[model samples]
Target chain A: MKLLEYQAKQRFAAAGIPVPPGRLARTPEEAAAAARELGRIAVKAQVPIGGRGKAGGIAVVDTPEEAQREAARILAMDIRGYPVRSVWCETGLSIDAELYLGITLDRDRRRLVIIFSAAGGMEIEQVAEEAPERIAKLWPDPFAGPQPFEIRRLAFAGLKHAPELHDRVPKLVSSLVGLTSRLYEVATSLDALTCEINPLVLTPEGNLVAADGKLEIDENADSRHKDIAEELARDETGDDGRSGDDPFEVEARKRGLTYVHLDGDIGCIGNGAGLTMNTLDLVKQHGGEPADFLDIGGGANAERVHNALEMVLLDPKVRGVFINIFGGITRGDEVARGIIAARDELHITKPLVVRMTGTMEEEGRKLLEEAGIVPAKTATGAAETIVQLTRAGSA
Target chain B: MSVLVDRSSRVLIQGITGREGSFHTAQMRAFGTNIVAGVSPGKGGTDQEGVPIFDTVADAVAATGADVSGIFVPPAFAADAIMESAAAGIELTVCITELIPVQDMIRAREFVIRSGHQLLGANCPGIVTPGQCKVGIIPNHINTPGPVGIVGRSGTLTYEVIQGLGQGGMGQTTSVGIGGDPVMGLSFPDVLQRFADDSETRAVVLIGEIGGSDEENAAAWIRGTGFDKPVVAFISGRTAPPGKRMGHAGAIISGNTGSAQSKLDALTAAGADIADTIEDVVRLTAVRLGTQPR
Candidate 1:
């Protein structure tokens, strides 16, 4: 979940961190109203991804009319594959100096690091690439919090031009650290996979602002976080009432087999997440749009296998079903039982392509053969079979 | 003969009352693990699958003399669980739960380090020494005890590698899934050091994915230490695009250096025997062990 710049700033403000006054707007009228409130303002496109400014998503405007015009252009444009939904109207700040502040997970050290730099408004990646020396990074004690000494050093190195902001730097750093820690708590509580805030800005008026933010709550943790679930449900689409088919698609997800419903006819079910994704890629390579991705899990018992097949069959868009299982813990024989059961129980009228490998593969194949089902030798063969079956079934 | 766990290791389950914890606990016990006790704060006096339940990990350890703990506590209480285990003098702690906050993990990690206890995962599959003790939720039926030692980041990918090895008739001595969280308790270097020193282990199968410098660090250690045993490596998520973090928090490759290709190159440069496919990995590992591929 990526929060736009204004959303992040709002969170920062809530956390007792000072941020420039800003409001988000979708239409020109809203933009005009925001500009009137802020006076001289910066109209920026609100998108989840970074590099919005370089992509012409941000523009400075003096009046409400100018702000509205810039907002209209930004909201209409698409930057970096994300469609612009709205723009942010923020008060223009006097530049005594620009500095960058951020807190992100440092995996290697197994700690949360606070990064600061005098060079602000540029991509952190670029800053790290070009002039690594300018950036001052600190790992605060999780128990003790960020020390005043560390903040002083960072301020001296990053914001050397503004000695007046030196006393305020530690407070801001401590608050940001506190906010990040709280956000981490929220993320864990919600089962979020990731939450990030970038380009935390400092103004001449001794205020700190989070210029951009992103929060990606984990779907697995959705059951625990009602707020996230409600938000997601409110933005739901398709037959499954999700924002997209990917949420319901079990084949592509981390745990269990996920099959996403795409705008295609061929349905795909495979054993592992990695193998399933590769299978989907292979299907696309073979010029077939995969209707869904389904995995039967490592231990594909009769019930799980039956359920997987039933789910795919329920999708009315599916013309053909592709069953690909790499039997390990899940023996091929067990898979065959589920497939046979689903075939009998559901009256599966669609053509089916089956591929099985691993333990008891021969037994599985024999069972399938007895049921008049021929299994494909390779993943490609199975995909091709489904494409052919869909074409033949449609014709 | 192997590292971390074996048949004699007594296992205790924290958060044993939870669905995932109880489910995997049963699975672990069925796989011949010595599950002596369970701990769920309010669920004391109740028995789960005949294992005695206690109010806390300390009480469970005191009652059963269990040295190793596998935690199934939810993320919110994970740090507390770890601290309790550490304070209880548990020798080894394997947290099967994922999505623990980075800050919580940092504090927990510091506490563990200061207390002189070893922790395995905050978001990982637990360690297993085949035919002896299995502490985590890995599918046991796919594994068989042998002379090869295995370590990996991804749980299912590790299973794939192990299955491939099993198909080729090359069983494992011990297999460790070090978890894919960025702030994990154990790293490849820590596990590799154990494998290198273990007398029963003849060879190693290292399965790594894109993300983190652990693989690179392990490669450096292997090169510098000069472990005589053959190490067959397979790096998954090779075709995975750069800048996209995968399902695991520790599985993201941010810059050019963290990709599967780069990791593969580093491993290759360090004199590791590389395998492209699962089949190839097992086949090469068998050949190196002087056992014909099945």
Candidate 2:
């Protein structure tokens, strides 16, 4: 799950990483109150995605009135696809320099890579592409954590380009080492796949503060951090990310099924993730756009299939559904039974062309034929059938 | 003559009494896998049907002389399960558990490497030697003993290709699922090398999804090593949007990398025949192997 800046700060503060004192404001009145408490403030949009600043979702205000006005503007604005439900009101930092520090999985090395760069703030990716050498990295041992010397080395390497900070290297490296250690603690403890403190703000006062924070927890390891997950879910102001998602996707999440809403009429379902994706590809290959990507997963019995059928047809745009099942642990006959039961019980009128094979597939085909549903001999043949059926039905 | 498991390989189940474990265990037994002892911690000295249950992997290994372990532990303990299998001296550990923490796998993978044992997946359908032995949960009936070898990242896509090949009258020597997690055991290169070593394996099918450098790495290995086996490759997620994970954790297009086009380009540059669909996979496999499709 991706946390908004304010939510990420909640974690950063808990981990003792310095973040400017901040409050979440759902309304302009709340923003004004926050501004009254903190003298010079920046009201930033609370959205899970980045590039919000460029999209005019952030504003600096000197007074409560200005804070209120900016907050009202940002809150009403929708950046990218995410509507700004809340704004983060926080005290402004004294200008000195911006440095980037983040930790993510280095899949090639199979280790947690800590990335540090003098080029910080929102455009770290651009900096990496242009300058490249400005970024320094360390792949720390999971058991031993980041060594002090390694972090110090990384900090200096990142600061090599900034000649102004060359004199302050001794003091800066120590602070960076401390900050990075805390970030590592947050990453390992929270099961964060992406834990970043972009624009590690260095003040004239000689302190490192996390100006902005980004934390994306590993979906696989989410069960271990139930408390954090619960806290994230409790925030109903949309940064929990469901508001940004399609209603169908949100519904799929509620139903505990893997579904991705697409812009098409062909509703595609398969037993596995790969097969589902391939089903979508095949739908397009046959000149039909896919409505959604749904994986019923292994051993998808009648009840699960019933739920999936109901869920897919919830979208009025879905003219037809193509359920491609090549059973491994998932039996073709079992899936056929589910499809038949769902179609009859729910009175589903949409076209369902099933391409069933493997593990009692003959029985599955027989059942589909008896039920008066289209039984396809091949996946491509099924895709062709579904597209033609849907197009003809619509015409 | 298969890559991992054969008829004589004794397979033990970790978390044998769990729902998935018990169900797949019955399936594996039905497929003629040598069912030995099982490990369920407190369930030691008990028997689930004919298979004996031991409290620990060490005890199970000692009793059954089991060299292969199929782990069905939950995500929380998946790493521990893999480590336990390694420490118990299992030659090949196949973990069917999904959602294992990457850090845990990083640690477990290190141990597995140091132990000199191969770990297949924390989220994968395990290895199957057709008409010989089965380790994890790939539907037993989709396969038959033949000269083709298969390796893939997705379970159902792998089954589709295997079934298609079978229907085309081309059976498989073994089908390896390296899994779809970003951090997984036994990558594409590892499985391809194993297939290269197996004499029964003729042409190989490489099934990949959008994610990581595993597919690219496989292509590089093939090019660099001068691997002689004819390779037919199929990559899914051609239309999947970036940053959105399509079911599998690894199937995401990040920034400019891990796209189907990139994987396909690399595989093509490496001289592997690329297939657009499951039907194409079978057709390409036949073309490469110089066999007439039935």
Candidate 3:
């Protein structure tokens, strides 16, 4: 759900907020063309993570040729584990003064805060660490809009030789707040976890612009946002880098489940997202690498369970499959039935470790045993079993 | 004799027609909750689990005299749903819907505060007075009515701790999941205040995760208020690396202040009896509350 900097700026421009003219380029040729259009530009790598400049992702190039060269360098690079897929070609701006503006959820106060500073182009974290006094934060009145006077004072304190920019700063702040509120609305509407615009910049020409943007929509809320849901579905269908043999894995993906192909050889499946993640962490903690994060949700029937086991065991790297169920709404007996059904249908060659809790756990365990699968009594026991299986080279 | 709700509390379920709403509603009813009315626009005049269905919260409240509402509206309309309940004069509104936009929550929270209405969560497990009323989706089987008041942010972790309490034969007065969302309706301090004043609640069990300053703030308040009741605390995600965001949308520890260690230190410094594990929480709570072994 994270929009690249260029995309966010485009959104800001669409909302009537003045943003520097920018073009996104996936290739060197596109970068050259973008640079030609912008004349003098800053070629910046388009990575979702921050600290791009310090990581040498941003370069100021005077000509199209230089812009293309910088774009090539950036696109070929991986700044912070995330590979730079494209470069943002933006028009270079005259600096009368630099200032920062952003809006984010303030969890402690249980409100949204507008953060502003005269020192733009610096990370907000750096500002907080070094010159905390320079930064001015304002909690906007939800009923009455952001106060101009409060923003003006903040801008005046953060910027140098920008008295002329003072009047426009508050106006821009109001607009930024409005944009943030709108973006938040869109994000929530789409079930996004976060939508952020960092280093909302102000230029010498008294123009305000969003320098960077990051939006991460919540996957849980995807069912409500049809547009995002369709996009996700399309993304899944179009992704075919890994194919064949892993039919169970393919099936799981088709069913809208996240199935990561890991080398650690332990296939981990669970009912809840939190439990799955914790199980993965515990597996890692216990010297076992989880092959996948497969959450069958709270209502995984017999068919889904069979499909899940097939998917996990299909991974060539998987030597053992671990099924952990903390049954609350979904009874343990249902999970047990699924395991039995899947075992009957699928050729699961790998050793299976099942840890079932809550209602009908004993019944579930009995069913698993009847199906020739020994169930682990505890989560720790299951995790240990996976580790032992992988270490002993026994499937 | 619970903090927020008990057997006599008449509950109304909003968004009762939806899948999640209906499922949890059935669970609550089975757990012996006084679920008098169900509300869902246009689905009104229909019945859910034999509970009388109403078009609006007002109608549900008017007919059933239900003062407490458990909301299951989706994230998109959750804010509006909360506002409706608040406007309808519901004294306490428990919103179980997760992933509500921060803006919507801000507006909903402001409106609730302005109108003098109390709201619980936009992403929470709801409140449960063990052996009495179960509102929201906290599993009823894991809990039992006792003398301890429990408050937590995470759902499963709270369940684990409560299960531990149950296993130790230490039932709870009321266990409230304040929710793991960034902008939740109720804070730890807010719930702790209620627990402090409640005569039936002899002790408090606080379950916190790394992220927001809610724990630190609660620690300060607890220190300042001088609540005589013993508090046993367990902070989860301690092994969670700094800057690594958890599954909860609100679960992110950005700086040093919001780290698990810092929160744990704060709680410890505030005189809260610390428990390393779920079982340890049970043992500490029993010892602190003078609940001897059966």
How close is chain B to the truth by TM-score, in each candidate? 0.97, 0.99, 0.97
TM-score of chain B alone in model 2:
0.99
Q: Predictions ranked by lDDT, top down?
A: 2, 3, 1
Of the candidates numbered 2 and 3, which has the greater DockQ value? Answer: 2
The top-ranked prediction according to lDDT is 2
Query: In model 3 chain B, which range of ten residues has the least summed lDDT?
Result: B238-247
Model 3: residues with Cα > 4 Å off, grouped in runs: A81-85, A142-204, A209-322, A349-351, A359-395, B242-244, B255-258, B292-294
Candidate 2 lDDT over A121-235, as tens digits, reads: 8577798899999999999987889999999999989999989888888999999888899999999988898999888999998899999999998877778878767876776
**Over 4 Å off in model 2, which ranges?**
A238-244, A360-370
Q: Model 1 over residues A254-370: C-alpha lDDT tens digits?
A: 334444555677887777544554556567767787776565644568888888888877668788888877663456898999999899899987898898776568899999999
CAPRI quality of model 1: acceptable
Per-residue C-alpha lDDT of model 1 across residues B178-291, encoded as one tens digit per residue: 877777787888999899889889989988877788888888888888867888887765655565554465655677766877878888988889886666787788888998
- What overall lDDT goes with each candidate model? 0.74, 0.89, 0.75
Q: What is the C-alpha RMSD of each candidate to the true structure, in Å?
A: 5.3, 2.0, 4.6
DockQ scores for all the models shown? 0.30, 0.75, 0.34
lDDT of 3 at B202: 90
Per-candidate TM-scores read 0.81, 0.96, 0.84
Better of 1 and 3 by TM-score: 3
Question: Cα lDDT of model 1 overall?
Answer: 0.74
